[model samples]
Target: MWLLLALVLLLVILALEMLRFVRNMRTIPGPLPLPLLGNAHLFLGLTPAEACLRMGELAEKHGDTFGLFLGPSYSVMLFNPRDVERVLSSTQLLTKSEEYSFLGRWLNEGLLVSNGRKWHRRRKIITPAFHFRILEQYVEIFDRQSLRLVEELKLRRSRGHAGVNLGEAIHLCTLDAICETAMGVSLNAQTNVDSEYVQAVKTISMVLHKRMFNILYRFDLTYMLTPLARAEKKALNVLHQFTEKIIVQRREELIRSGKEQEASTKEDVDDVGAKRKMAFLDILLQSTIDERPLNNLDIREEVDTFMFEGHDTTSSALMFFFYNIATHPEAQQKCFEEVMSVVGQDKSTPVTYELLNKLHYVDLCVKETLRMYPSVPLLGRKVLEDCEINGKLIPAGTNIGISPLYLGRREELFSEPNSFKPERFDVVTTAEKLNPYAYIPFSAGPRNCIGQKFAMLEIKAIVANVLRHYAVDFVGDTSKPPVLIAELILRTKDPLMFKLRERVY
Candidate 1:
């Protein structure tokens, strides 16, 4: 009789839980979810590339805004620009969603993941590092790296105009450029493609993507038992050690040169007789918040954040730009003409800040590419307070997802949204009157990407340099789009191939 009573009590508890779930489901429209698992079954075993496609399909069926449960977490996907702005523009919703906690082991409380007071403090300290004057100093590094990339392409073409994976090559070039500009260290990653640090960065990104989609890996105890976790541990060691070494070396160098004291007072500019300007790391070393200087850990976290954000996102954008320009011959030619006009037909001439600014047509192409394929397809925030979107009440603590990827493709916003038309960005056209929140490839409002200007400059420098030295041609079917995956950034499931023909003056 006692055993029968215990069984009855268990059933009562489960019935109550089911009743609560049903009541919550009535408020939102989405696919019916299975108990306990929620919608995890739909995404299980799907690659990031496959997952993005699946999400798009669901969006088509469920409309612009829908709700789903990812293992008890109520998530609302916002594809409408107005809905996205409602969440992103809120000061109360500034905290990143729980999914970002996965990155805390690597990024810590860096500018990308921190919230509230910590975020404000770091943002204030780091904003000066990207000032126009400081970015001008970075232009030389961008030019040098671009030249190296062009040289690499030339060497490859000398053998034959064989199809080359420009995506991988551009990633290496960007990695090298960011390392030099952000850390004041030459990784030579463009030449040394198989470096350990490069491999570690790649490994960490893959592991993170895997953990994100696999619910089984979301729990700490379960994840720690997996082989992927072991690999992640090793990769973190490599990444942390690399950044820590750079931080220590930079600090020691400042102290040895007796510039440590001077750094705190002097303007962040190149020293009188120095050949190289101070890097982003140098600025961090001198920065303080609340009269307290940043410690070594703080310095490493920021450096790591900058290195990853600075390289990966820009490389992804450039990959899509290459694909767009290569497929659109007219646009490609127009960009080439604009580049040649700015640089005066000298392939060896370095790209200067002023010269980069003049490549107006090339900038349009980059912007168009970003519109079609934003590097960061989704941004997430935790709703800290109850909010209303499209007349629907979004309860506090709900996870809100904003997709720039979907917003950019809305027919109501852009005519021929699927087409690669650089002219859509012309200042004289109606595109100039479009809503600012509508075309937020770099996001919008207060929490937008701080490195957007730096990214654009780097992209323009490389694109101009490449077009001046080589005529890129598509090697595959131009009619079909590449299969895109939502990793930490946007990526292609397969290699994006292109043919580079040596340009004749």
Candidate 2:
């Protein structure tokens, strides 16, 4: 009798969920979904690049706002800037989507995925780590790493290599810079390109990407039985062990130098001594919540977050920036001229923060690149409470998908959206006015990227350094552009090749 009663209760709950799903289907416009599977079949067996194109087709068919169901989970793709504003700008709707849970084993409660009070507390603690004073110091690391990359590229040009892959080169350059700045140690990723830590990061990221899109791998019970699970475990072990080891080493160095105690006593990072620079890990080590210092696990999560976020995103931005300027010779020349005028022709003179600030034309080119190929092609958020977004009532538990890729290409938002025009972002050009939410490469509002300044500074430094040394030209056919793979970061399926000619000013 008890078993029968329990079965009846379960049926009733399932019935109610179906009713809610029906209500959503009636309210929103999208491709008709089959029962049980919904739109999951549309995405199944598709590569990330193919899947990205498929999403574009769906948006074109369903208008700005549409609903899709992957299994039992319902997601509303917000293509309209107003709807995106309604979701991203809301403080109450800050919870990440279920899709982000794929990163749980690796990132844990890191700032990127953490929500509610935990996110709030962590954000507050980590914000100061990117303050202008600290960022000013990071410029040294950026200049050094970028110079190393420039030398490597120059070496390749000398060896009769007509083309260099900017994608691979920038990834290593950014990795080296992030390691030194975030952990106060050099993995020398640019030098030791085959390091165990670098390989583990790549391995784990690939496994996570595979799991995120595969409906069959969503659940832990089923996923654990798969071969990818073994790869995930091994990669995660290497990642966690490396992060923990670095955290221990950094903390010990801080203690021995007496900077850890000094940082703890200080109310602000600016108050910390100017003689010694603090890594992001050092700041987390000194930080406390509810009067208790954060342990090794706490420090590791934030550091690993920095390591992942800092390098990958910046590398994507740089790759696109290189491709954009390489294709647009006029824009590339303008950037080269600006860099020469601002930083001078001396390639040996490192790009300083002050010099980087003065390259206004280069800044415009960087902005355009971000608009065209945002590092994070898509952003996801989950609705915790039933909320009215852009005058429509979206039910709670619905996933929100905001694609910067689609938004950037909307003809209504940007004039000549398909063309690469750096002047589109120039303040004096009024061809099209931009909504703050419309062109969010670094995102917008309260939960916007805290390290945006750091990213911009690094990008400009690298671009200026490269342009100052070499004239870059695209190596691919204009008619056949590289296919974009919308993974953790936006990347092309093929390497973005560039030919560099040494410029003698």
Candidate 3:
């Protein structure tokens, strides 16, 4: 009798759940979902970008948009370029999701993570910091870093190593650039190369990225009992301490010097990327939202957030650019020809903004590279209010995953899309399927990356400097499709190795 009663009770619970599931299933188009789990399990083991791509494939398989339940957290995956444009650009439909509790803790309320009125205001304030004229003023900063990198390569050339870790070199250069430009102090990361601050920054970012997808982490209650949560908090502490020291010291130094303007010489970048009339921190320090100055904590979070954002994305981009150039001889040769022809033979002669812009092929190459391996693989925007997408009734409190990673690889979007062919991006062919949102490497929206100008300039400078010194040669099968681990950005599980041969032209 007891056994029978237990079975009956279980059946009753199952039946009630089934009824609720059926009722909830009325609105969206998706595969038959298992009780409790939903379609979210389909993303297991995949990077968020790859998971997003899988969702697109499923959408094409099933048609248009689909419903996924991340355990109980419901989200609608938007794959159509038109739909993506609406959600990403429109303030009406969606807002930045606060998935990472720790990120909110670490980044505070900076532009990348902030939303609504605050995001709008902060984005406007930070906009002036990245203007074209201001970037042109930042040219020497790019120059100094490139020079330091070349000088380092020369050291390796003299020592006769198979190849220096270009990824490591680029990392240091961008770190120094970010520190000086954003934090207002030169870490001299390019020369020191192994500073604890540098190591801590990378660790914190990697940890932070790891934390993004972790579901159990979302519950505030579970975090208190979890070992991973404790370690994450500890890691955050290290990163906070690192950036705080830089911020406090730099602010003091600036106040003492009494120089608070961008009216200085290129000599400002003592380490590299110098001559900025402003430390990026100073601008943000003086930044006001509705005329209220940012507090110390607010300022620290913004600066720490920007430092990681400014450095990692740009450096990883350059690393992939080298990997692609090394693998594709014809493409690399074309890029080399363009760089050589326009601004050639001398590393000391700075690459100007006009000349960098003129290197359309290089631009296309970076675009192509990013499409294949996007720096930020996935973006999540949660619905601020109840909305309709593709005429489907999407409820409030739903997360929407908008991924360029999937959009770039669609067979319908580009002919032979999986192939690494920068040539496809040439003017005539590109105009045929001209949805501007289809190829959103930096993303397409009002909330697009603020430092896009600075990133590109630095990348172009590095490529020009690199090609001028050495002709890249792959040590092994650089053609093999790399396994990219997409966390905050898509990065390789292994080093993209090569044998560097000095070009004596």
Q: Which predicted model would earn the best TM-score?
A: 2
Compute each candidate's TM-score over C-alphas: 0.93, 0.94, 0.85
* lDDT-superior candidate, 1 or 2: 2
Give the Å error, residue 14, model 3.
15
Q: What C-alpha lDDT, on a 0 to 100 scale, does residue 78 get in candidate 1?
A: 84
Q: Quote the positional error of residue 76 for candidate 2 in Å.
A: 0.5
Q: What does candidate 2 score on TM?
A: 0.94
Q: What CA root-mean-square deviation does each model show from the true structure?
A: 3.9, 3.2, 5.7
RMSD of 1: 3.9
C-alpha displacement of 401 in model 2, angstroms?
A: 0.5
Tens digit per residue, CA lDDT, model 1, 1-505:
8656754664464455444445666676677777666677788888878888889888999888787777536788888878877777777778888788888888898988999998988998888888777888899999999999998877666655558888888999999999998889999988887899999999988887777767878766458879999998999999999999989998998899987776663263344214457689998988777767799999988998898789989999999999998998899999999998899887788898899999888988999899999998888888778777778778776788888888888888888899998888888764445666778888887788999999999999999899998888989987799988887688888888889988898
For 1-505, candidate 3 gives per-residue lDDT tens digits of: 8657755665565455444444555876767766644554677677655754576578787665776665445666777888888787886753676564457767877777877787787787777677666677566677777878888777765665655677777888888888777776778887786676776676667557655666555445445567766666776787688778776776677567765333232232231223436667766655666656666777787787788688888888888888888888998899989998889776557888788888889988987888777777777888767777657776666778767777777787877877888876778666545478777778777878888888888888788878877888766564467666666776777666666777787
Model 1 lDDT, full chain set: 0.84
Tens digits of per-residue lDDT for model 2, 1-505: 8657755664465455555666887778888766556677899889889999999999899889888877547788999998888878888988999889888888899998999899999998888888777888899899999999988887767764758887788899999999899888888887787999889888887887777777788756558889999998999999899889988887787789776665774375567625567788878888888867899998888888888889999999999998988888888888888888898877788888898889888888889999989999989999888888877778999888899988998999998897898888888864667888999998887789989999999999999888888889899887666799988789998888888888887
Clash number by candidate, in order: 0, 0, 3
lDDT of 3: 0.72
